[model samples]
Target: MNKITKALGLSLLLSSAVSVYAQQPPKHTYKPDGYSIVTIETPEDVRFHATGLDSTSTGEVYVATRFGDVWKLAGDKWSKFAEGLHEPTGLLVDDDGSIVVAQKPEFTRLRDTDNDGQADEYSMLAGDWDFHDNYHEFTFGPVKDKAGNYYGTLNLSHGDPDAFSLGAMGSSGGYRGFAFKVNKDGEFSPYAWGLRSPAGLGSSPEGELFYTDNQGDWVPTSTFHLLQEGKFYGHPVSLAQRPGYSKESITNTAVEVFDKIREKPVALIPHLEVANSPGNPAWDTTKGQFGPFAGQIFIGDQTQSNIFRVLLDKVNGVYQGAVINFMNGFQSGNIRNEFDIKGQLWVGQTARGWGAAGGKPFGLQKVVWDGTTPFELHNIKLTKTGFTLTFTDKVDVNSVSLDSFSAQQWNYHYSGNYGSPKMNLEAVKPSKVSLSADKLTVTIDMPLTADKLVQIDFPGLKDINGRNVGVEKVYYTLNQLRK
Candidate 1:
């Protein structure tokens, strides 16, 4: 087809999609109680399809949008701080009040030198990697470590094109699916590879780096993986940057070799059940100021238009954990989130390139807990028998029984498919139930299964006061059975 014909065809298809999308109800319709979602109004001039969010010590909020602009929200007033940036996916407010952002081509730091409320000094802290001009070549990052180094992830180009609109088999990009770290002196280097569409990057409270990668051809499932150097995270295309690495080394290698070498996700989220495109993770370190689940990670989904909570546990020096659906019915696709000093969550949302379930195109909302502690299992600790669950309140053993619990074990296939279906499903029967004297812990008599996911549903588990569990389901990744 000719150029004009192709353009017309694409335009028509997009318009038809918009017309169809307008007629359907939002994907997220269920509204949970006790928590309120307050929409914070952004500026009227631009479409505030915010993708990055951070806040300063003085309570000023900063946001980076897909339109290449960064703004600060202070006491209901929006002020433009920076402009004419690329598609920025992440934002961080440094300790000195400077704005650090991760744009498509590089990571940058913007500073308002004159206190004029606008950034006059723009510094490109990291660059010179590769850009293929492909539509899917998006970058996400600039999250800092305790040592002041900046980190980001480069996404693999998905289309069949070259860097300059020319046709090619692949873009010949460098470090496309790799994660990099920029030192304090602006030294940029690739740190980890095998990442495809890694949308969010953050540090755990324990000071370990982690990122969220989406499900695709090489990715078996949406996962949350701890960032370890030299780790090939299942996607082989990124191994090109490794020293002496080859395509044959990856493609022809056995699954056992890859499994033994590459790292695993701390928590594997089921497709479309909890998250479709999980975004950034923000931990609630408020020590009960936020809620009962302190030091837990709360993540948002762009397509799912919801939020979920993750609890991590280390077994044999490796991280594995549980993921639970926390809250839903957000105003848009949640891409970036920040927890303020007051313990309220600031969610920046967008539906620009992807459709969201909240029925809106763009919005900024504040998620606040209504001060009511929800009865929930906080974490699962490994034990010799099986595992022990710690809850927010004392468990009433009278309300917990075999009838209230049902569990099974399942594993995923390591392959090149779009995703992995649950394989080797096994029913797990609880041989006994042991409650702690304090009522906060419950030990089950089920035997521990190594390297398997235990799918537990506690529909009848209740707190000491007979309050039903707020989160009924939890998928625990039990990697190792301890003695």
Candidate 2:
């Protein structure tokens, strides 16, 4: 009753503990190589649900939240810089040191008078466009051009009389669903029309403006477009705001007419697989401070709760590119991203109204590079025969084979429907695969076509050390072929 009974009881307890440990789920963590995410602590009482992010020259970070407040981050402290904004979606620290914000009503400039560290001057920069009390008429951007003009994209409203019956996104107010420019004199001019849910906007390293749009009626999927003046993107309902056209006139126009004039997007962000709600396209102007991805575009997805990289190229005078997954597993919906002076990428997150994968309501974080480069695809270029894929590091040439890569191509239909399915999908078989002498590039010879979305999967790709690449898939929007 002493030794035998105690030993039997202890064995049963240990067995139960082991069983419970095996049944528990494994902890999920995001540890991308060569980069680390540092979560920024916010005020316990404040929601800090950020919608826009920007930084000053002195390395002070500013965030505009959906709750109508602008907060500044200096060192490790957060302070309210301004308040009473009407749901600001984008913020810009102008060259003049004034904070210009794209709020729901208008673009407002906030100036910190007397060096009080708080903005006391609230002045309107541009408010020519009309706005009703609709909740969906959000404005994004205020990205400045080289000519000193400020640009903002207006979102289509819901519950409007002129709203398209297909996608339900409409522009009852003037200039809704359009990109407008505010001149230095504060004169407002409509620049480009036919944008639906233009959530993110950014200027390329060359000062060329680009915008990201969500998938909806008239939008096949999430898209990134070069914001050229007078170019119609895709949504036909936005035509009602054009001169000589009313709601009835636009409704009577054929969809073919709009299709013919619709400008192609630089890249189509694949739905579900890539991003459902993509935010700002922040270019890595860090100049190698953020590792090998200098000059590439880093975009955060609000719904996916992740950041992806875009490598852009110009073909036949048009902008097109590929998107590769960069980092994932944020704490909330990553709505805005800004690169600070130290080349660290600050991500502002929110999950209000729409749900996000991160499961948190609001937060802030930054991604820092450890100076080590990961083995990944650097960029992809369309060649006359096929494609030229470059890598950040040397590749294991022995692991390269025809079976290591597979590809498919498809296009979306232009219509009044909500998010067309991938049409005419077909497998693309490569005829030849060649590794470059430097082992940093791969050339594939295949039958190439124009005006299609090409996806290449290289799950078996490895670096010179025989380690797998960081990202295994690449989605390229092929609008043109090389001459």
Candidate 3:
């Protein structure tokens, strides 16, 4: 028989061979000092779960919750700004101050028709999902790349019930996940295929998309797969051997599929015990050529309750491989796991499901780098900030603390306060500004001062260990308003 025929004939055999090898738990070294954790207030003090968070250029915070709700963090108070979502996972704001949410199986554009704070109607931007069965568990992303196109992922929660009795292993036919894109007019189309549970989705500085998947609980190892356009990262039949299948038979079939996906992934994190702490995945884009992380990918491991950094070494235009490790830990032993955002090498995490301080189960943390012979920061942008500041890469937020800018002048620096910056810019109106876990933006208000010079500093930004947080600065000359 031909290659395809031969592979199919012994597909069951290869599956069994892969099963004999037990998956070992991946090691994650602790870096408690890499991050500066800051807790933002939650809407419901009694009970709340933060699903999605993003900042605007003006510094307003938008946080999505489980109860079909979106909360805004302004100053110290939380307010219900948007509602009627069925498990919001990803949040993004457009240049027009419009908000978009990926509410599993649906990508929704929430608009406030009357200029009211709350969204009046939920406009279906573009989503083609079978929401009835995979309603809440599936993860759909509405992330807009620098090019303005929207991308999202679909996740399969559980396998089919009949497949279990039929000697089938892993997800079989019930729910197959894929990635898709939406046009400007809200048309949904398939982008890529072959994903088990792609939960977290984000793009790197190089315009590559990365996603996290939850393999079947029965499998020995879970997987974190990366994608380009239409590549399969091995799932369902590839990760685990079928229950009654022959090892040699399935192994051959899997090799062919593995080859296709193996090259696409920047790294393969072996998932042992609880999906290997898989959560949101992002890329660090905060370097102007001086440092170790000119092009690195960052992700969060929920199971270990830590954030991970995957450094990529590309040789001759091809990605040779990557080095993975724990970037930082949160709240002593608390699970500061999942919902990750990145600035450059600096990573921000949202605290969830743990008895820790800082916004308990809902707040933001900043990871920064210290400038020395080895580290540097450049290509920074205020980007979209309001309630949060979304960077092209991860940044040290603690060092960039806000103390309300004074008209006279001030001196501020980073003392491990997330290696932010020295200058602080305060809004003319406290209510005009908002904050979130990672983004900051300006809304409605005109620019401040003819020559508004805002400076931010970071004194204690560190690496994985407790070192100095690096310094990276961006300047925006604010022009006075025209009367």
Off by over 4 Å in 3: 1-35, 159-175, 215-225, 236-264, 272-275, 286-295, 331-364, 367-483
Q: List the residue pairs that clash in candidate 2.
A: none
Clashes of 1: 0
- Backbone clashes, each candidate: 0, 0, 98
User: What would the TM-scores of all predictions be?
Assistant: 0.90, 0.92, 0.58
After TM-score superposition, what is the CA distance of residue 20 in candidate 3 from its true location, in Å?
Answer: 13
Highest TM-score model number: 2
Q: For residues 304-423, write the lDDT of model 1, one tens digit per residue.
A: 789888888887777889888888888789988889887888999997666888879898998888887667778887777777888887888897677777789888776555567778
- Candidate 3 lDDT, 1-483, residue by residue in tens: 111111111111111212222343334444422334454445445334555666666556676654467777666777777775666667777667878877754677777889768777676676555543433245556677667779887665433453321122333332335577776767776676656556577766666666665433222233444566645554434233323444344444543444444323443343332224356665544453213445555566544445555434343353322223434344222211222232323122333432222223444444454443333232222222211222233333443333322122122221111111225446332223332344222122223343233222223333333344333222232212223
Model 3 scores what on Cα lDDT? Answer: 0.45
Worst 10 residues of 3 by lDDT: 5-14
Report model 3's TM-score to 2 decimal places.
0.58
Best by lDDT: 2
Ranking by TM-score, best first? 2, 1, 3
**Global Cα lDDT for candidate 2:** 0.83
